[model samples]
Target: MLVLPKESRKLFKGPFGILHRDISTVLPELAGRTVYTVGDVVTHTLQKNGITPSIAVVDGQTMRSPCSRMPEFSGECIRVENPAGTITDDLVKALTYAINHTPVTIVVNGEEDLAVIPLVIAAPEAAVVLYGQPHKGIVLRTIDAGAKAAAQELLGLFVRVGA
Candidate 1:
Protein backbone atom coordinates (compact mmCIF):
# COMPACT_ATOMS: atom_id res chain seq x y z
CA MET A 1 0.00 0.00 0.00
CA LEU A 2 0.97 3.64 -0.42
CA VAL A 3 -0.03 6.44 1.88
CA LEU A 4 -0.56 10.06 0.87
CA PRO A 5 1.44 12.08 3.34
CA LYS A 6 0.03 15.19 4.99
CA GLU A 7 2.12 17.45 2.78
CA SER A 8 0.60 15.85 -0.31
CA ARG A 9 -2.94 16.66 0.75
CA LYS A 10 -2.83 20.04 -0.91
CA LEU A 11 -1.38 18.54 -4.05
CA PHE A 12 -4.59 16.60 -4.67
CA LYS A 13 -6.96 19.44 -3.94
CA GLY A 14 -7.75 20.63 -7.47
CA PRO A 15 -9.12 18.83 -10.51
CA PHE A 16 -6.43 17.26 -12.62
CA GLY A 17 -8.34 17.48 -15.89
CA ILE A 18 -10.86 19.57 -17.77
CA LEU A 19 -13.89 20.43 -15.65
CA HIS A 20 -17.40 20.28 -17.00
CA ARG A 21 -20.58 21.20 -15.22
CA ASP A 22 -22.60 19.27 -17.78
CA ILE A 23 -21.15 15.97 -18.91
CA SER A 24 -23.62 15.56 -21.73
CA THR A 25 -21.42 17.26 -24.28
CA VAL A 26 -18.64 14.79 -23.63
CA LEU A 27 -20.84 11.65 -23.56
CA PRO A 28 -21.93 11.63 -27.20
CA GLU A 29 -18.31 11.85 -28.29
CA LEU A 30 -17.32 8.86 -26.18
CA ALA A 31 -19.51 6.26 -27.80
CA GLY A 32 -17.72 3.05 -28.82
CA ARG A 33 -14.77 4.02 -26.68
CA THR A 34 -13.28 2.92 -23.38
CA VAL A 35 -14.59 5.36 -20.81
CA TYR A 36 -13.89 5.28 -17.08
CA THR A 37 -15.63 6.98 -14.16
CA VAL A 38 -14.13 7.43 -10.68
CA GLY A 39 -16.70 8.47 -8.11
CA ASP A 40 -20.24 7.60 -7.11
CA VAL A 41 -21.80 10.79 -8.38
CA VAL A 42 -20.11 10.63 -11.77
CA THR A 43 -20.71 6.90 -12.15
CA HIS A 44 -24.37 7.34 -11.27
CA THR A 45 -24.64 10.24 -13.65
CA LEU A 46 -23.25 8.23 -16.53
CA GLN A 47 -25.67 5.40 -15.86
CA LYS A 48 -28.55 7.84 -15.67
CA ASN A 49 -27.50 9.49 -18.89
CA GLY A 50 -27.41 6.13 -20.67
CA ILE A 51 -23.63 6.09 -20.99
CA THR A 52 -22.40 2.96 -19.27
CA PRO A 53 -18.71 3.41 -18.65
CA SER A 54 -16.29 0.62 -19.45
CA ILE A 55 -15.00 0.57 -15.88
CA ALA A 56 -16.27 2.55 -12.91
CA VAL A 57 -14.65 2.98 -9.48
CA VAL A 58 -17.06 3.90 -6.73
CA ASP A 59 -16.98 3.86 -2.90
CA GLY A 60 -20.74 3.98 -2.30
CA GLN A 61 -20.36 7.42 -0.84
CA THR A 62 -20.22 11.03 -1.96
CA MET A 63 -18.47 13.91 -0.21
CA ARG A 64 -17.13 11.44 2.39
CA SER A 65 -20.60 10.56 3.55
CA PRO A 66 -22.72 7.46 3.00
CA CYS A 67 -24.57 8.12 -0.21
CA SER A 68 -28.31 7.71 -0.32
CA ARG A 69 -28.14 6.54 -3.94
CA MET A 70 -25.61 3.92 -4.83
CA PRO A 71 -24.61 3.14 -8.39
CA GLU A 72 -26.04 -0.13 -9.68
CA PHE A 73 -23.94 -1.95 -12.22
CA SER A 74 -25.07 -5.09 -14.03
CA GLY A 75 -21.58 -6.28 -14.89
CA GLU A 76 -18.96 -7.87 -12.65
CA CYS A 77 -18.34 -6.31 -9.25
CA ILE A 78 -14.84 -6.08 -7.80
CA ARG A 79 -14.41 -5.31 -4.10
CA VAL A 80 -11.23 -3.92 -2.54
CA GLU A 81 -10.28 -2.44 0.82
CA ASN A 82 -8.36 0.83 0.52
CA PRO A 83 -8.47 3.27 3.38
CA ALA A 84 -8.96 6.97 2.91
CA GLY A 85 -5.90 8.74 1.49
CA THR A 86 -4.12 5.45 0.78
CA ILE A 87 -3.78 3.13 -2.18
CA THR A 88 -3.43 -0.61 -1.72
CA ASP A 89 -2.12 -3.38 -3.94
CA ASP A 90 -5.60 -4.83 -3.97
CA LEU A 91 -6.92 -1.66 -5.52
CA VAL A 92 -4.28 -1.73 -8.22
CA LYS A 93 -5.01 -5.33 -9.10
CA ALA A 94 -8.72 -4.70 -9.31
CA LEU A 95 -8.20 -1.67 -11.55
CA THR A 96 -5.87 -3.56 -13.87
CA TYR A 97 -8.39 -6.34 -14.20
CA ALA A 98 -11.31 -3.99 -14.70
CA ILE A 99 -9.54 -2.12 -17.51
CA ASN A 100 -9.45 -5.26 -19.61
CA HIS A 101 -12.89 -6.47 -18.55
CA THR A 102 -15.30 -3.84 -19.76
CA PRO A 103 -18.42 -2.71 -17.91
CA VAL A 104 -17.16 -3.44 -14.43
CA THR A 105 -17.86 -1.64 -11.17
CA ILE A 106 -15.08 -1.61 -8.60
CA VAL A 107 -16.61 -1.07 -5.19
CA VAL A 108 -14.03 0.22 -2.76
CA ASN A 109 -14.68 -0.48 0.93
CA GLY A 110 -12.90 2.53 2.34
CA GLU A 111 -12.42 5.13 -0.40
CA GLU A 112 -11.92 5.39 -4.13
CA ASP A 113 -10.49 8.88 -4.44
CA LEU A 114 -6.90 7.87 -5.01
CA ALA A 115 -7.84 5.11 -7.44
CA VAL A 116 -7.78 7.64 -10.25
CA ILE A 117 -4.04 8.12 -9.92
CA PRO A 118 -3.19 4.51 -10.72
CA LEU A 119 -5.99 4.37 -13.24
CA VAL A 120 -4.66 7.33 -15.19
CA ILE A 121 -1.27 5.67 -15.28
CA ALA A 122 -2.75 2.37 -16.45
CA ALA A 123 -5.26 3.66 -18.96
CA PRO A 124 -4.51 3.21 -22.61
CA GLU A 125 -4.23 6.00 -25.15
CA ALA A 126 -7.47 7.57 -26.39
CA ALA A 127 -9.44 6.31 -23.41
CA VAL A 128 -11.13 8.94 -21.31
CA VAL A 129 -11.46 8.99 -17.52
CA LEU A 130 -14.29 11.09 -16.11
CA TYR A 131 -14.62 11.84 -12.40
CA GLY A 132 -16.65 14.21 -10.26
CA GLN A 133 -15.05 17.25 -8.60
CA PRO A 134 -17.40 17.55 -5.66
CA HIS A 135 -19.31 20.83 -5.98
CA LYS A 136 -17.16 22.06 -8.81
CA GLY A 137 -18.13 19.73 -11.66
CA ILE A 138 -17.00 16.68 -13.59
CA VAL A 139 -13.38 16.24 -14.66
CA LEU A 140 -12.46 14.58 -17.93
CA ARG A 141 -8.96 13.25 -18.39
CA THR A 142 -7.98 11.95 -21.76
CA ILE A 143 -5.44 9.24 -21.25
CA ASP A 144 -2.16 9.85 -23.02
CA ALA A 145 1.51 10.40 -22.37
CA GLY A 146 0.91 13.69 -20.56
CA ALA A 147 -1.86 12.30 -18.42
CA LYS A 148 0.27 9.31 -17.49
CA ALA A 149 3.18 11.56 -16.63
CA ALA A 150 0.96 13.78 -14.50
CA ALA A 151 -0.38 10.78 -12.67
CA GLN A 152 3.12 9.46 -12.15
CA GLU A 153 4.10 12.78 -10.61
CA LEU A 154 1.22 12.45 -8.17
CA LEU A 155 2.13 8.81 -7.51
CA GLY A 156 5.55 9.98 -6.42
CA LEU A 157 3.95 12.02 -3.65
CA PHE A 158 2.83 8.84 -1.93
CA VAL A 159 4.97 7.06 0.65
CA ARG A 160 5.19 3.31 0.24
CA VAL A 161 4.04 1.27 3.22
CA GLY A 162 4.51 -2.33 4.38
CA ALA A 163 2.22 -4.86 6.02
Candidate 2:
Protein backbone atom coordinates (compact mmCIF):
# COMPACT_ATOMS: atom_id res chain seq x y z
CA MET A 1 0.00 0.00 0.00
CA LEU A 2 1.18 3.53 -0.60
CA VAL A 3 2.03 5.50 2.48
CA LEU A 4 1.40 9.21 3.13
CA PRO A 5 3.46 11.90 4.83
CA LYS A 6 3.16 12.15 8.62
CA GLU A 7 0.54 14.91 8.60
CA SER A 8 -1.32 13.35 5.71
CA ARG A 9 -1.40 9.94 7.37
CA LYS A 10 -2.72 11.43 10.60
CA LEU A 11 -5.48 13.25 8.75
CA PHE A 12 -6.43 9.94 7.16
CA LYS A 13 -6.93 7.95 10.36
CA GLY A 14 -10.70 8.26 10.85
CA PRO A 15 -13.55 9.25 8.55
CA PHE A 16 -10.87 10.72 6.32
CA GLY A 17 -9.90 7.21 5.30
CA ILE A 18 -11.84 7.85 2.12
CA LEU A 19 -9.40 10.58 1.11
CA HIS A 20 -6.19 8.77 1.96
CA ARG A 21 -3.25 7.86 -0.30
CA ASP A 22 -2.52 7.19 -4.00
CA ILE A 23 -5.77 8.05 -5.76
CA SER A 24 -4.52 9.05 -9.20
CA THR A 25 -4.39 5.35 -10.01
CA VAL A 26 -7.87 4.77 -8.70
CA LEU A 27 -9.89 7.45 -10.57
CA PRO A 28 -9.36 6.15 -14.06
CA GLU A 29 -10.18 2.58 -13.10
CA LEU A 30 -13.36 3.60 -11.35
CA ALA A 31 -14.45 5.69 -14.34
CA GLY A 32 -14.38 2.54 -16.43
CA ARG A 33 -16.76 0.61 -14.22
CA THR A 34 -19.60 3.13 -13.96
CA VAL A 35 -22.75 2.03 -15.76
CA TYR A 36 -24.48 4.47 -18.13
CA THR A 37 -27.61 6.15 -16.79
CA VAL A 38 -28.75 9.77 -16.49
CA GLY A 39 -29.35 10.10 -12.79
CA ASP A 40 -26.18 8.31 -11.83
CA VAL A 41 -24.06 10.59 -13.99
CA VAL A 42 -25.66 13.75 -12.64
CA THR A 43 -25.02 12.73 -9.05
CA HIS A 44 -21.45 11.76 -9.77
CA THR A 45 -20.83 15.04 -11.53
CA LEU A 46 -22.28 17.00 -8.64
CA GLN A 47 -20.07 15.22 -6.14
CA LYS A 48 -17.04 15.86 -8.30
CA ASN A 49 -17.93 19.57 -8.28
CA GLY A 50 -17.66 19.61 -4.48
CA ILE A 51 -21.36 19.96 -3.83
CA THR A 52 -22.64 17.24 -1.56
CA PRO A 53 -25.65 15.80 -3.33
CA SER A 54 -28.26 15.44 -0.66
CA ILE A 55 -30.76 13.28 -2.59
CA ALA A 56 -31.99 12.01 -5.98
CA VAL A 57 -35.60 11.26 -6.95
CA VAL A 58 -35.88 8.90 -9.95
CA ASP A 59 -39.24 9.66 -11.56
CA GLY A 60 -38.95 11.28 -15.00
CA GLN A 61 -41.45 13.90 -13.93
CA THR A 62 -39.04 15.08 -11.29
CA MET A 63 -36.31 15.49 -13.87
CA ARG A 64 -38.71 17.59 -15.93
CA SER A 65 -38.98 20.18 -13.25
CA PRO A 66 -36.63 23.08 -13.72
CA CYS A 67 -33.25 22.69 -12.05
CA SER A 68 -33.01 26.44 -11.58
CA ARG A 69 -33.44 26.15 -7.84
CA MET A 70 -30.93 23.38 -7.52
CA PRO A 71 -27.53 24.36 -6.26
CA GLU A 72 -24.71 24.81 -8.78
CA PHE A 73 -22.85 21.67 -9.82
CA SER A 74 -19.60 20.81 -11.61
CA GLY A 75 -21.03 18.75 -14.45
CA GLU A 76 -23.80 18.85 -16.97
CA CYS A 77 -27.14 17.05 -16.66
CA ILE A 78 -27.65 14.11 -18.99
CA ARG A 79 -30.49 11.77 -19.89
CA VAL A 80 -30.19 8.04 -20.51
CA GLU A 81 -32.85 5.80 -21.95
CA ASN A 82 -33.14 2.04 -22.16
CA PRO A 83 -30.69 0.76 -24.75
CA ALA A 84 -32.83 -2.04 -26.14
CA GLY A 85 -36.21 -0.43 -26.56
CA THR A 86 -36.03 3.37 -26.67
CA ILE A 87 -32.44 4.29 -27.30
CA THR A 88 -32.15 6.94 -29.97
CA ASP A 89 -29.41 8.85 -31.72
CA ASP A 90 -30.52 12.02 -29.96
CA LEU A 91 -30.04 10.49 -26.54
CA VAL A 92 -26.70 9.07 -27.51
CA LYS A 93 -25.68 12.43 -28.91
CA ALA A 94 -26.66 14.11 -25.70
CA LEU A 95 -24.59 11.67 -23.73
CA THR A 96 -21.63 12.29 -25.97
CA TYR A 97 -22.06 16.00 -25.62
CA ALA A 98 -22.17 15.83 -21.87
CA ILE A 99 -19.17 13.57 -21.68
CA ASN A 100 -17.08 15.60 -24.08
CA HIS A 101 -17.86 18.68 -22.07
CA THR A 102 -15.75 19.67 -19.10
CA PRO A 103 -16.00 17.88 -15.75
CA VAL A 104 -18.41 19.23 -13.19
CA THR A 105 -19.04 17.93 -9.70
CA ILE A 106 -22.67 17.25 -8.83
CA VAL A 107 -24.90 15.23 -6.53
CA VAL A 108 -27.30 13.12 -8.51
CA ASN A 109 -30.91 12.77 -7.53
CA GLY A 110 -33.31 10.88 -9.74
CA GLU A 111 -35.37 7.74 -10.22
CA GLU A 112 -33.83 4.31 -9.80
CA ASP A 113 -34.49 3.48 -13.46
CA LEU A 114 -32.16 6.27 -14.59
CA ALA A 115 -29.19 5.37 -12.43
CA VAL A 116 -26.88 4.72 -15.39
CA ILE A 117 -26.82 8.37 -16.45
CA PRO A 118 -23.37 9.04 -15.04
CA LEU A 119 -21.58 6.52 -17.22
CA VAL A 120 -22.95 7.95 -20.43
CA ILE A 121 -22.25 11.55 -19.48
CA ALA A 122 -18.65 11.09 -18.46
CA ALA A 123 -15.98 11.72 -21.09
CA PRO A 124 -14.67 8.45 -22.49
CA GLU A 125 -11.20 9.48 -21.34
CA ALA A 126 -12.32 10.61 -17.90
CA ALA A 127 -12.42 8.02 -15.15
CA VAL A 128 -15.54 8.72 -13.10
CA VAL A 129 -18.83 7.03 -12.28
CA LEU A 130 -21.94 7.38 -10.21
CA TYR A 131 -22.45 4.19 -8.26
CA GLY A 132 -23.13 4.98 -4.64
CA GLN A 133 -25.53 6.40 -2.10
CA PRO A 134 -23.76 9.48 -0.81
CA HIS A 135 -25.86 9.80 2.32
CA LYS A 136 -25.21 6.24 3.42
CA GLY A 137 -21.76 6.30 1.80
CA ILE A 138 -22.48 3.10 -0.14
CA VAL A 139 -22.14 2.22 -3.80
CA LEU A 140 -22.77 -0.55 -6.36
CA ARG A 141 -24.00 -3.75 -4.83
CA THR A 142 -21.38 -4.92 -2.38
CA ILE A 143 -22.07 -8.59 -3.01
CA ASP A 144 -21.26 -8.30 -6.69
CA ALA A 145 -17.50 -8.57 -6.86
CA GLY A 146 -17.09 -6.54 -10.03
CA ALA A 147 -19.50 -3.89 -8.90
CA LYS A 148 -17.82 -3.61 -5.53
CA ALA A 149 -14.39 -3.30 -7.09
CA ALA A 150 -15.64 -0.63 -9.45
CA ALA A 151 -17.23 1.28 -6.59
CA GLN A 152 -14.09 1.12 -4.46
CA GLU A 153 -12.00 2.30 -7.36
CA LEU A 154 -14.41 5.16 -8.07
CA LEU A 155 -14.46 6.12 -4.40
CA GLY A 156 -10.70 6.42 -4.41
CA LEU A 157 -10.84 8.60 -7.48
CA PHE A 158 -13.61 10.78 -6.11
CA VAL A 159 -11.69 11.56 -2.95
CA ARG A 160 -8.93 13.24 -4.92
CA VAL A 161 -10.96 14.33 -7.90
CA GLY A 162 -13.55 16.22 -5.87
CA ALA A 163 -11.26 19.18 -5.85
Per-candidate clash tally = 0, 27
Report the CA-based lDDT of candidate 2 relative to the real structure: 0.33
TM-score of each: 0.95, 0.31
Stretch of 10 with least lDDT, candidate 2: 12-21
lDDT of 2 by residue, 1-163 (tens): 1112334333322321132133233344343243222244334444454433322312222234533333344345443343221223434354455444544222322233223332323334223333333333323221244443543443333211111
After superposition, the stretches of candidate 1 with alpha carbons farther than 4 Å from their true spots are none
Candidate whose TM-score is highest: 1
Query: Candidate 2, residue 132: CA error in Å?
Result: 5.2
The per-model lDDT (C-alpha) reads: 0.90, 0.33
- On a 0 to 100 scale, what is the lDDT of residue 2 in model 1? 97
Looking at model 1, report the run of 10 residues with the lowest lDDT sum.
24-33
